[model samples]
Target: MAVNLNDDLEFVDDDYFDMFEFEDEGFEVNRLRREGNSAGPDDVEDASKQKSDTSALEYRKGKDMQGIPWERLNYTRDKYREMRLKQYKNFQNLSRPHHGLEKECKQVKSGSRFYDFQSNTRLVKSTIVHFQLRNLLWATSKHDVYTVQNYSVMHWSSLLQRGQEVLNVAGQIAPTQKYHGSSPRPLSRVQISTMAVKDNLMVAGGFQGEVICKYLNQSGVAFCTNLTDSDNAITNAVDIYQPSNGSTRVMTANNDSYVRVFDVERFVLLNRFPHSWSVNNTSVSPDGKLLAVLGDSTECLVADPQTGKAIGSLKGHFDYSFASAWHPDGRILATGNQDKTCRLWDIRNPSQSVAVLKGRMGAIRGLKFSSDGRFMAMAEPADFVHICDATSDYYCTQEIDLFGEIAGISFSLDSEALFVGVADRTYGSLLEFNRRNQFHFLDSFF
Candidate 1:
């Protein structure tokens, strides 16, 4: 759009395009002067005459709200039209996708099964899964949803519950874009199976796309450029990684071909590593030295992140290595796949399988090693999250029904807690495993 800080200003949006008129400048001055002269000097009142003049002035002013002189109204109109055109152009420029030039890039299908890392031990029995959607993720609250555009407010007093009795409520909500930002928040970006939020930052990584680092501001919601595009240096271009620590940092993963360390605030890319196939998932090692990347295309390669050389290819899963994880000590790597079996590999020798975890027939997608590295939690395509002994193969001793299709699961930093994604809602859950080793619903935050 055109910028005019001067008295004469013009702004145009794309709503009306072909209506602009073209005229040279001198014509505008002469025309305005002519209109001024026709109006004559202001006759201070002949009450009736003044009334007529006032009426005419009001009508004229209404036609020139931008405050441009009557004759220049046409020029202003054209300026507005041009402004609109420019805005449209600007939108187009921003909408175009930047072929992300993440170094050593490889493309992979986003929902590939290569993200789960399972452990079979004599530990637990089952696990849970949650998180499913239509508009993706705009966490629904109570009986209503906060839409993308309408950040409205509703009075909390507005309802009731009728049972053998009845239900009622009070108050109402007023939805408006008033508190909204310059753009509508995206309902979804790449499916970030895990979103790690710490302090003011939220890091997401999952879908076979870019990991996004979202910086929160005082805005009504979190602040980040979003899935659309990046201007002014904020966006979803970086591959995000959330180590056990809550601090948010984005890794560089473009396509699936390469992986690199990325600094969120500066958008700087560093420490690039090439992958043999498109990466299904990137997990930071518990020790923080290794980055485990699960790949599916043809050969799945695991390499020393620092050296950028292939350590070896994990061979076990028939179709693809759907899920994998590194032991806390960083000595072992475990993988789950579409065939419904989980394999354990020793990183020192990736070519051999030390153990096989089997049970379910469908995909086993979620995996977690207890903070003590003594127990493991694994979830299948079903509703259970299984707790297993990490030392022994497939040694599940207990289980918990997450009550929905399992999407993701994790043990908290202290192993005292577990988070499971609920399929029917956008917001996942925070469940605590008490000393009795039972899962407790953490509903206080709700």
Candidate 2:
């Protein structure tokens, strides 16, 4: 005797798409299997009869699925929308088309808010970025372009009559400009690594953004009014240095995996060298022909400036690179990294660091060759700065009183002065070294 079991397997549950709860149907199947109410392995042999039974079952799946508990599904899509909007609000507000104030700060007037910082000894009170009322021969220029003026207000009575025409060191200074009051599209990027400020021309670059140039010497007559983005871009402008090509040629390295050169005047795309991973910074050779790019990927790249072609890529830094500079002679490159050390390399065989300068606990952030190339100053985020001789590859001398993380540094063109920009809990100021070989605080320019 054959017992017919025809209506147990069908797919018509209304809440089928909601796989959240399948418990009710699971219980039904178990009960039927245990009580012998549904087909077992023996039911498939008679295919013709099974077809009729399967059709009847298809029409009754909901009947079997009824009374299943409907648990509510949980998920919301609004929280993500709120986060993205807040991240982009501040940039939108500050970028509301230039309000046309002073335009770009061009010629900083001698005594106005727009002149050079007069480091005169006569200034009864010395302030950072400015001198006091009676002492300032020329006020610091609000314009980013600085004037080369060396004058002493107190010695005027003696030198003023000695058959001498007043010398404005900036008599030959000229701004790099394309047109008058030319404003281009503003960019999303604000901070840039390298800034080339000469005469009245200022060019800056940032990570994965366009290269930008500003004309700041128009006195009140501003030229490039807006920051225009360029096609030849960088990742972070992580490291910026200029070669002495006699023209303002800015070399930049970005985290975006490349080193680029920008022609400031035309704002032209000069050259690009591909560097994968994060490039720490770039150092231009003394001859202005070679550039050394230290990579966070553990390598140093030496390349020809004119060709954007790599002479070689060498691996030396044990860990991610943090800082680097060119030797005074241009044949050697030096690199610092998160590994807590600095290393010297030969451009020809950059794969190996010839010497290691060690001591810092944190990654190095600042490195600069002294004006005479006799020494290189290596700085970390700590309170002290390290000084190493160009000839000796070790930490020969140290200055312990330096404070905060050394964020940036430079030597005066004359090599007679060293300038350091530091970063601490609050905004920091500069440290100065003068001809008297005396070290002092640079009047903070803020």
Candidate 3:
């Protein structure tokens, strides 16, 4: 199957046409090696390792933690960055002038150091099934991270410097507990497209519209089902949030132009919201009163969470939106678009956006707000991840430069660490950045 672009998989770009071509060969080699002994993504050692020693978090100060051998690649870091800027193409469904909002954006300065680079671990290679979907990585705490690696959902630990398979969808999956309104048959060879982890509950959405829910503390699959049977039925996004009623819910945005909410406890369908366009992503407000829906349309809808009624519409985006995030304060909403921009909107006045942020290259595939509401991280499709100061109206930012396609960006629940997943075959690894503060020294003492 081809990578789904434009929500309906109607558009295809050459950049990602050969993405899945290299997976089968790699998977077969790794499968045979795993039968003999345990081997992770960090098991390989190349001649470049003799040049400079690097490991997950075992490097001395001032050493290159990423271990990228620019000399071997025959291109300097600066030269490659320039090449990507000129050659990388941003996928777009609509041909519209992009310079209109560029004038309104402020010249964002990039010297701010809110988070400092800590380490990079090749122990777990992050992979994405869909090129446009990027919510694959999730950090439950400063030490634990969950990401997709081929056919398995792998969990990596910064403290242990090792990884373990959490869920494997390479075979068949059936719900452990059956409930009403469930699929009768089990799903085999499921390919996960998007995932979200929160409050000990992890929900993964597949390309075949399969919703698989698992609890980190529990064993085996908690619940699993195929959400839609349509030919174009792809689960684009999954979000787990607790509303004001204190009940846990899972919301899935599907290419079938519907957002389905499920009760977590019973694993039963609660409500379904219909949309005019394919819903790429949906986010409920922190208070659980409002919902932000983005998809094939340029405008994002702010609706009542219960009824899914359109209370307001945010206009100004030039292309399709793939990501949406809400601040903890519940007043600000950030939407990422294929137009290579992320716009911040104020809920009180939905007439226009408060700020417009541009990307280095490619589209803004993911947006994340720190749990403390202190910072916001925006990720492009590759190489660049921007961290902005949410308290300062997003004027100051720190651009993290690396070489790889970004699988996802996630902030730890405590807001102490930021994790970036690189999906490249050569530099495929997980990068870590610790929150910079005066109390950081206290961690060493502990």
Candidate 4:
């Protein structure tokens, strides 16, 4: 029940729109125009200055945070949203009734702006390799962000307003460090499907079941390996975390119906947990005792990390789930589904979800909880990201409406900055938002 982008298949859906092709055409047109109108030194300098001015981290009172000029585009915001909803097709592996999903959803209270939009910059363009995957972006700090752009993993520094290439997977890359039990073969042109960066270590999963690891402080890739030899192999998600034993580890969910764990230091396999369905995503609890496994089934399982024993099962979703996250307190768990809803469950109760949050127009592809456990963010497939207040039982929320497919979402370690990746060729950029706290008063004093 997993979708393989490597297959060449025919489609029959009425609303099937080639959005990626459209975006590519737009990018080509822009490139040709820029080449035709070659500017002199003065014009080039002025253009560069203009781009810098727009890309800076500035907050204007009445301007749109996304820099989308709806009035001048000959279409209103509402009309564009209507068109998207009518044309957008949600991908599903299982046939089910989707029209009745709204009946089970709870309407979230709107107009609570806990985070203010700080900037929208086109300098750092984020690209998506697979449309169904949205786990490519990560923020190591408030000023540092990493995302996929074509074949490169790019690092963008908000403080300096510049970008640098962290790792280029376009060329042949072989692991420099050799492990005893791991196969060391040169991998070329790996199509990365998902990635995670934490505590100076970055790990990326590929469409061909390759796991690539690199240290930010080091020069080259530390380790690389292919997890499976199956034809339908795809690494769906990668989670980098520390266990209770204080050892760093990496967990990956794959389309092979296995959740594989690897020791970070030795780059060796630690454990492999088999599931009934193709595992889409996995998140370990804060205490590192419990694991949440979600995939092609409507029911999600709570399992043990060390042993592959099922602790409990949560059932409420009518469609497959693609994303999961644990609150810092390790009590509440959130899972995003193709049913256009994100369900929050209390692990202690495990009977039903405590809250059912609905999306605006599409599937909830990504979810993240702030480090302080104060806010939870849910991202749709495109054009919507919702921030829910954790203290208010998730009733109060703020909706961030934008244009483009979301590559991913991440919160800084300090819970001060939120970064969203937009993957459209024309409107592709990284969006940053800052928490609305009283600490900004100190900025004026400085």
Clashing residue pair totals per candidate (backbone < 3 A)? 63, 18, 0, 0
Task: Give stretches of model 3 more than 4 Å off.
Answer: 1-63, 180-185, 439-446
In Å, residue 145's CA in model 2 sits off its true spot by 11
259: Cα error in model 2, Å: 2.6
* Candidate 3, residue 416: how far the Cα is off, in Å: 0.5
Judged by TM-score, which candidate is best? 4
- The lDDT values for all models are 0.39, 0.42, 0.83, 0.82
For every candidate in turn, the CA RMSD to the true structure comes to 23.7, 30.7, 5.0, 3.9
- lDDT per residue for candidate 3 within 307-383, as digits (tens), equals 98999999999999999999999999999999889999999998999999999887899999999999999999888
Q: Model 4, which residues run further than 4 Å from truth?
A: 7-63, 98-103, 439-446
lDDT, candidate 1, 32-119, per-residue tens: 4566754333322232222221121343336221112436445554565454334422111012232322221222112211112211
Best by lDDT: 3
lDDT, candidate 4, equals 0.82
For residues 221-290, what per-residue lDDT tens digits would candidate 2 score against the true structure?
Answer: 1122122234433333322345665776655555456666656555445676776665546767777878
TM-score of each: 0.48, 0.51, 0.88, 0.89
For model 3, state the Cα shift of residue 40 in Å: 16
Number of the candidate with higher TM-score, 1 or 4: 4
- In the range 1-446, model 4's lDDT, one tens digit per residue, is 46646532111121232232233213433444587667565565455434332432334544445555455566777787788878777776667776666666777789998887777777677766666679989999999999988778999998887799999998899877877776556788888889999989999998888899999999889898789988767899999888889899899999899999999878889899988889989999999999999988999999988886898999999888999999999999999998888999999998989889999887899999999999999999888999999999898999998878889999999999999998765556889888888775544432
Candidate 2 local Cα displacement, residue 316, angstroms:
2.0
- TM-score-better candidate, 2 vs 4: 4
Task: Pull out the clashing pairs in model 4.
Answer: none
